[model samples]
Target: MLKELDLARREAEVSSLAQAEQDELAELREWLAAPEGAKDEHRRIAGLRAEVKEWQETYKKEKASWMRAICELTKQRDLQVSRADLFAKQLGQWRDIFQETDLTNLEQEWDPESSFYANEDAERRECQP
Candidate 1:
């Protein structure tokens, strides 16, 4: 439309009109390519979003793995602490029992010919008869 309008008004300036038409065509081509360039930019934005989503998913997976590992370690540590506490209580009781026992009297009583053993044997014989 512009070319035809300009041609009708500028019959005497053919060369100048031709140059103006070429310049207008170049401007129109650039305008037409704008949407296509925007489409390429949109594609690049979509690709970047996809990459970000992939990285976020990987981070979530790794965080979950680390949480599981920490939970497992905590459970193991608790179990070990409980076992150690139980062992400590049992050892304390054994130590108390050992400290209360008279090792010298126990050894003497263990001898068969000791007077305490003889007295026990006499009591047994009397009970049997």
Candidate 2:
């Protein structure tokens, strides 16, 4: 009687273990068959992120180049404006110097008395009929 009871208990334990293994295998198969795109989604998201990073880098470089060009152009424009102002100031100074010289007064001060009749008048008077 004892031998028979021990054999039956061992057989039940084996059957339960086999059933548990089958359940575990069935759960694994169901998980594999489900439509989960986690791996693919991860790859796609990573690709999109890389593209965004590249675009951002390109934009930054272009922006920096544009800023540099603007700065250089501004400097050139300022230099041109400064040169024009200096030229105008020099022209004003020259005008002031010419005004001070007063050429009209000089001409009047050096006028000759009977300026056009000195030798000519003497010759005409000596040859009068």
- Which candidate leads the pack in TM-score? 1
Question: Where does candidate 1 clash, by residue pair?
Answer: none
- Alpha-carbon runs more than 4 Å astray in model 2: 1-36, 105-129
The sequence of per-residue lDDT tens digits that candidate 2 reaches over residues 1-129 is 547856986797689669868865775566567568754665565578569768966986797688679879999999999999999999999999998886877776764655676768778889999
Q: What TM-score against the true fold does each predicted structure earn?
A: 0.55, 0.52
- Distance from true position, residue 10, model 1, in Å? 72
Candidate 1 lDDT over 57-119, as tens digits, reads 698679768867987999999999999999999999999999998788777567666678798
Alpha-carbon shift of residue 94 in model 1 (angstroms): 0.3
Task: State each model's C-alpha RMSD to the native.
Answer: 25.4, 30.0
